[model samples]
Target: MRVPRSAAVWMACCMALALAGCGADKVEASGTTDENGACVLTIGTLGPLAGPAADFGLSMKGTADLAAAEVNQQGGLRVGERTCHVRVSAYDTGYTSAGAANGAGEFIGQGIRFVIGPMGATEVTGMKPLAGRNDMLLVANGFGRDALQPQYPLVFHVAPGPSVWAAPIIAEARKHFSFNKVTIVATSDQSGSDIADVNEIRFTQAGLPVSRESYQRGTQDFAPIVSRILGHDPDLVDLASTPAADAGTMVKQLRQAGYTGTFCRLGGESTAEIARVAGGNDVLGNFFYYSMVDLSDPRMQHLSAEYEQIAGRPATSLTLGWLPAARALLRAISAAGTTTDTQAVAARLRQDPLEDPDLGRGVWTGQQEFGVDQEMSFPFYMGYIRDGQPQPLVRLEATQP
Candidate 1:
């Protein structure tokens, strides 16, 4: 598929900016001073801007850009004595390990101290070592079991994976749907396998027998996989960690194959896109998925409004999920009063309360899973599709560590 024109333009701009200082090895000023002599802090956003997962990457980048614009609109972030303007530098990682590592390297050359993403497991795995060596902080997104560890203190998770929220989400689904067995479909990569492993455990613990099926990344056809899944006679099909595009295609194929079972996705937020690709709500029939935000909340609505105003486009569901993390990073930088001292910034990040006027209060979790309390826990919702129409979302309270 061809890359969207808007995405292509954004990618060109970001690559040009990232490569401008490729020869610089020393840590220079995080940003250049404006004509008024105020600091300009440039933060990087790393993710795929073109590919099956581009929706996720673009959403993350857009949110980070929106966060920076919000600060700039308010006269910039106050770091001690200097008023620093936030500038976002985005790089399209193409959902590849090499692409991610290369993007991080360019950011390092440009003296970027912080990054908002590198969403894929492969991307995170590729970027972490470089980020650690450079003392660059990452508010990253990845579902791999080992995505976060105490050894990598500078890397903080944007949200918990299935290990933290899967059980509750599964239990909630059980209240409305009756499913005796489940078939989990995911990619064969670590990103897919890791999340599938977590969801398998959750489903089994909930008394549902489970089976697993995986496809290689970039597979457009789901016929063979759907055939294997139907062999299990599953009452519920869990799209665990599959990209939204792939999941939607699978949904369409499964429905065409006369499978009238319920569908659930315990991964990323892309329900609207999924529905569109699946041929609409009727094709989805009975569906449930994790919603990163309660859109009905007035504050969340305000966030979407602000994003549209600044970005000149509507925010994707996944875009809203990234705002709290981006906001947290900027707030931490402000509190630390130094863009260069990442250790101090990281310390302040952990100390600051996980509160956002638009996102409400959250908590720092992940100790039980990642052995570090660095994952931000926030209130999420379960979106339900009943008989080809959307229903009111059920809000779940935020979890504690």
Candidate 2:
């Protein structure tokens, strides 16, 4: 990925921090004052820059760059009497705990108190301790929020956690189908289990009997799993907490198994990718995927075009949310008047909800959910796969338990 103008200079600084052995003390200012005497606030991105999850990380990085560029285009951020120009610095997490911790340590040493990603659940959880230890504010775009948020108070889940969207999805699903029983097929991971648990509760609460099946990551053969799940005669199959590839595979294999049942992915990205992998949209024509943005919205169309121009590819459902989260983070810093005081910025984030241009109005609040006021609450979008395309269904208001 090409580094954004805001992040063009951080390569050497990142190398220096790595070479210095990640000292405990914070490093010097990441950027110098410009001719206007404006301070430059450096926001870092710690995510997978290489390997299998590269696309996910790069998409986030690219969109965040767009957000930063947009902020900079608006005369930068106003902080007290002077302005603070924003610069983004990206570090690769390699989709490993050690890598995530190392990258986070380097960011902490370099005085990056605010960051945008550690996109997947593994990396998000891996970097949590480091974030709390350094008092960094991470607006995460991953799952496992119900478990991690209570443990890592500084990490705010900006993306819709599995449970966060369960109520609305269940209610909507009830309206479309006559299902007395549902089956959940999820990856056997912390996030998957947590999502399944939540979905089970929601489905049961909705008067639907629910059964769950778990698959280890990288498992290719879904024939048996699909058969086993279908054996229970579930009217609805919830691909809860599945990654895009896995969800696509299950959809294809399940449909081939002649199981004409309703399908809904609880937490995943890119229905187009799923449809492509599933061989046709008809396989997933009834499939509904949780979305963070309403793609049909004019603002989204404009941003999508702009993002495509900058990224050289069309943005996916997951990619769109990061820009809004970045915008919210920057706005909070501006409101707090300092990027260094994470508490003040967090307080501001709680005080004033950010009206994301794409996702609509939302706030950073976890008080009701995680016992901490950190997670972002926003409208959840439901997208349906129709003839090889993702179509917007409804924008459900954010619900709190």
Candidate 3:
């Protein structure tokens, strides 16, 4: 008999609840699946550990693990009088929906109460039922709209939404490009369309008349759409896509067709590796994107140093997104003093006001004021791809969108 997605977590729920001891045993850390639930209260970050977007998942995972290590070092999460050192069960989702669903089942079987995950939209959707069934809270790192919409009460988003991103991209365009006309091209999927929605709303709101085209995620030819965009004589083109190999193909075709207008991408790919495949110089110079944090900022210099030690690479703004979300869950669990019931912690997330600097470098408010929508209140930073690297635009002052 095939178990339902939620059943896996539900079956393990009793075992997990029994196994939930708020005791701070020696903090044992390992990066293997065989070690699941070997220690009390295991938490995890699920994503590609050795796949195509491995760099993307690994960088974020490194930061999450580092955050866990830091908390555990301080004697772990304090649930009332008991201190529980967190054990992490990091899993790879292989950047596929099926892989993510299976990963969710594994974490449930391991009897985990909290999870950080599968950094893409499809993957998050795959794991949603499992999280909901277990009543376990999932802090998602991706900006997929489905996770937020249709409301996963048990799931929380740490990264700001695409709505948080769009206004800033338009604002930056005004400084660098003539704001006469614009075109937006996006994937037909939920994540892509959601980002396009933000771009369309903000583009006109920013006082620039905009035109748009929606394309399938992996379409080989954009010339037909590019032809339509060029007819508008657009000064700018917004390309919104999920991070994957297909986005690279689209970027290459756009540039190869001699489209000179600036093309700004939403969430840059794994490591600018997309640049190499998508025509390094041409693609990098014209890309406008949202980067969650700036490693160059003196404020984030500390995290940059630490990220290098942890992930073996300089931290990008996106790396900062996962840690704060994970920490938020840990904080709620600590404040509520119980792991068996996430409701108390969920209530704190709903009832209590939060202003955390580490999460998103500013004050945070939950659904109480925002109507069951806000996960964190970190402001978005406008970024551009420069010289084969992603960097902050720097000219536009930061503001909430």
Please report the candidate that would top lDDT against the real structure.
Answer: 1
Q: Check candidate 3 and list the clashing pairs.
A: 264-288, 293-317
Q: lDDT by residue for model 1 over 1-401, one digit each (tens)? A: 33323223333332343344321223223446768877999989999888778898889899898778777766677665677888989999988889899999999999888999888788899999999999999999998888998999999998878777788888888888888989999999888988899899898888889999999999977899999999999989999889888999999999999999999999777888888889999999999989888777776676777778778888876788777788778777766667798887797788756765566688889889888899998887888888888888888878862
lDDT of 2 by residue, 159-178 (tens): 65766777787787666556
- TM-score of model 1 (CA atoms): 0.91
Residue 328 displacement in candidate 1 (angstroms): 1.1
Looking at model 1, the pairs that clash are none
Best by TM-score: 1
Number of clashes found in candidate 3: 2
What TM-score does each of the candidates earn? 0.91, 0.83, 0.76
Look at candidate 2 and tell me the lDDT of residue 361. 73
lDDT of 2 at 111: 80
Q: Summarize candidate 3's per-residue lDDT along 1-401 as a digit string, tens digits.
A: 33322223222332233245322232223221333433245677888777446766776677576566656555455565456666777888876678788888887787776777766677777888877877767777566646554356777766655556566666765675554777877667665666676667777788878777776644666677657766777767766654545555556776676766666666443436556667675574566666656556665676566567655776655666455566666666665666666656675454323333443344443343224554665655566654445555453332344
Go through the candidates in order and give each one's C-alpha lDDT.
Answer: 0.82, 0.70, 0.61
lDDT of 3 at 28: 25
Cα displacement (Å) at residue 52, model 3: 5.2
User: Relative to the unseen true structure, what is the C-alpha lDDT of residue 125 in candidate 2, on a scale of 0 to 100?
Assistant: 71
